[model samples]
Target: MSAHPEAARASSSTPQGKPRKAAFAAWIGSVLEYYDFFIYGSAAALIFPKVFFSPDDPATATLISLATFGVAYAARPVGALFLGHFGDRLGRRKIMVWTLVLMGVSTFLIGCLPTYAQVGTLAPVLLVLMRVLQGLSAAGEQASANAMTLEHAPENRRGYYTSFTLNGTQAGQILATLAFIPVAALPDEQLYSWGWRIPFLLSVVAAVAGYLIRRNLDETPVFQQASADQDVARMPLVELVRNHWADVLRVVAAALIATASTIFSVWALTYATSDAVGLSKSGMLWASGCANAVALLAIPLWARLSDRIGRKPVFLTGALGCAVMIYVYLWAISTGSYPLVFATGLLFFGVVYSAANGIWPSFYGEMFPARVRLSGMAVGTQIGFAFAGFAVTFAARIAGPDGDNWKGVATFTAVFCVICAIAVATGRETHKVPTAELGLRPAKEPAKPQISESVSS
Candidate 1:
């Protein structure tokens, strides 16, 4: 397809720092947003059961706590519907700034809320409410960030540039895990009483930094031209449903790849610490930290490779690799082999899974036009991620009668990874498609050379 002349010109005129600035802003913003998100997941697995619910049955309390973690995901699609509209209509920077503030406020409030001892049933209720708000904030964070980075990036390097968003996500998970390491070590009394609150409150630092970084950046020229051309949709959801339902379904299926992450991070943590396996909480957290740290290096490297190759090959390798490796990693943890656990975790989550993680922003964002890009990505991914959020509960259920069936959980994870690979295989290749021509139904052909006046005379 022929590229848009204006967009090509805009690309040529791009300032040296624009792409880097966009990538940096996205990375920092994502780190802050996900820090707030992952810390809640950590607490759900490690602390919330005892502090937010009754102590009647440990298993039931744990279930309820993990369910609360899933509640945020319930609100995400709804949040995406609204936040994505504003992002597509108003501007990416506006949505980015607002989401960070909302996330910070919600996380800080979580730090201040009273415990089950003090508030009875109200504690869990308020926790759910705050989680919903966090969900709302998170709904738009990554989609907008991905759109911002992808649109600003050079055509051939979109994979590498857009990857900074996931890199930020990994950094957030690493920071959240590191933040919990010391707290997880404390005596139960001190840990539950105050140590748990420390991480939640520290989100303010990330909030401030993300806000200042995003506040000054200009909107993407693609979006600016869309506005000038009056190409912006009045209701992006309606447009998305009418024109691009297939692509939306593709994103949702592709996004299920997240089950691997939730399994690795939340389900695996809890399972490893259960009596059946018996690893220390600190050891699991450290293993998670090491995997994420390696992902920091591996994600960008894979992303750069995707720039050279197509996005599908790299993504499929990761998806299918994750399907096989989940078993290996879980079996290692089941055997209480810490060294093997660390090594496999790094390979599975860090290297193999990272191919999908790093490529998805550019891969998925390219599926829709600028008019509905933010809304399409937000809604599709949030829905898919909703399943991912509940993957913890589902894996727990899949663990069977004894609740230690690593095989059952691994099978469940592998099934979904296969689904993601299938979805990606069905989509059009966008790595070589110009940013301007992306998402157009019948791609326009290049102009033919004109005959000279002298030759005609």
Candidate 2:
């Protein structure tokens, strides 16, 4: 296979890179995109059961609502394949703008949906359809944004620049949680009726803002050069599979680390505020908000550290640390100790998980040549994330009757974290490799002839 000429040019053209502007664009776009995506999670856990599903069986309704949250994940891989192909074929900037628009439109429509009481079975069906659209939009958002930032980043600081995408994500999560605090506090009648729609309706503003920002952004020079050189893969997915399948599988496994996020943000929220724990919904939201606020500071720092050291160590630290901390965080919630919950939540998610979250964009994007980078990252990560998306429903089922099975949920999450660590362990250390040489097989050294002293004489 031919080497990526754009990578060679990118390695030398540091001054031409738009690291700051591109990073900011990626950051703001993710903030809006994930804000739209996460609001559904908050509603699913807190409001959707009563509004969208049959109220006759509260337990069944809760499980079904959570399942609706996962419905987006099912659609993500499909979107990844379609959007990723065009992203590689057309350009990343176009896909970024499209995803923002789709997410905003779907989210706004979700706010306008009629409740189960109003429309009977059609309510959940509409909810699921909207969630699927959100999932599809999300499928391309991170991968395209990550590719844009990374290709525009200076070779030595790719981790730090790409980190902005996730920083935006953490910020979005904070916004989503905070948005729900006031709404969640409304009286049940008002909450079920109209208060819940406010957050979803607010997505239009974010979407419009994100669209404007993304549209003004220039395409990454790396991608532009590839296009000029006619180096863009005609079938990026086919090329990706032929040359980078193992890396794809590795990314799929490494991406499972996201299971921890869903469990913490969604399932744990439900568990903490359940009748069993008796924790206030506002308190849990505040705790989540605080942790994500801390993560905003921590993500770039961890990404910068990965730039200095390597993606593996920082990533492994996060994966392993999260494996242990899941137990501690969940245990804190189960004990009904608000202090411990806050402390451990900050430690587990804000500080520790940010290491993995901040670095994966750079780490995974580096695994493929520029030709296939977007497709590989999108397809592989989305497939793995599909499982992560459903993790809430699985956590609900594993928690058993009364939903006090915090340990079971913790164990399930921990196992995936460990798997993430192990998968990353087997992958190449791409940090030290030059941008031009990434995804190219290293040249084999010529064999030296063994000569004895007698033979030499």
Candidate 3:
């Protein structure tokens, strides 16, 4: 959570530099927010079917459990609309505080809910409601965090700084995946009874730690400058739709790449556990944990690569490469080849997709003008994320009892990659643009020169 050396060096006599403290503040806040989001993702796949839902039909249980997971996506855009307004009007800092507190309370509540045996139908009902709350809070979290960091970042290092926010997301995924390792290894009876609750309950610790780090940070100079000028839009959404509509649509299309990620992570876990593949849940969990760990390193490397080249090539490479690799990755799971699965799974999710993942926070945020940047990003991404929300259902239908349908899933994922490739290709390069120039009208006419009294005479 501490500021990096670059950030610290830039923060000196002149305030015209990187906001190291503010960026780190956003980084730590995003880490906490995603921690709350991803733990439920882990639980939805591994525990929720049995823990909260009816135990009758396996297929129905899986659908209902996945439905609970999708519930959060439902609230994402709504939260985006609500929270994003304040982020544009008030400041990125205030929305972040609310996002963390709301996610923390919701996640902690999920931990305390009674099981179906204890409370009957109320168990899953409360779980869905809590997931909706988490979804709503999560809607604006990453955008606000990324906006804070990007605004505070140096012109040359926007990709690098923005990527740090997602590294927090990957860190959260690592923690969420690792949290399941011990729990999944527990005996079936005890695991279902109580083991699964430990990870969710840890939200209290995360919430407190996040608050400590995030509270000390101040508003970014970009927003402060806009405020001082009394120039911020009363309706950021109206401006976003008017001027940045094309970019908003572009980000929406690009975010479909996320479907490949959530499906590969969550639904693939369920597929491996099914009778067709018969992989122990622990083995799958280890694969996920290590893959996420690899991403911690891969994300930064890819982000730096984007800084050197452009985001388009790197993003396309990642999407296309990951699409090709999913076939082998799924094949490894189906064949029960642990060595292959472990290696390829880590390679695909951790390394390949990371190129796309790390670049997007900045890429999407850069698409809009500063005034409506948060609103445009949050609404576009969460809406694009909706496809991924139902990906479990789509993947389930695609894979079915014909578990050999790895071919079908791979083809579907590849189509998604190609679509995103076209989308990101349209984006203009913003790595050199100053934060102040973003979302503002371009200057056209040449400036008039001052005249001396002698020249006038």
Q: State which candidate has the highest lDDT.
A: 2
**Candidate 3, 39-96: lDDT as tens digits:** 8988898888888988886677787788788889878988888887889999888888
**Each candidate's TM vs. the true structure?**
0.94, 0.95, 0.92
Candidate 2: C-alpha lDDT? 0.93
- Highest TM-score among the candidates is held by which one? 2
Q: Residues 15-90, candidate 2: write the lDDT tens digits.
A: 4668899999999999999999999999999999999988899999999999999999989999999999999999
List the global CA lDDT of all models: 0.91, 0.93, 0.81
Ranking by lDDT: 2, 1, 3
Candidate 2 to truth, TM: 0.95
Per-model root-mean-square deviation over C-alphas: 4.1, 2.9, 5.8
Off by over 4 Å in 1: 1-17, 443-457
Query: In candidate 2, how many Å is residue 2 off?
Result: 14
Cα deviation of 394, candidate 2, in Å: 1.0
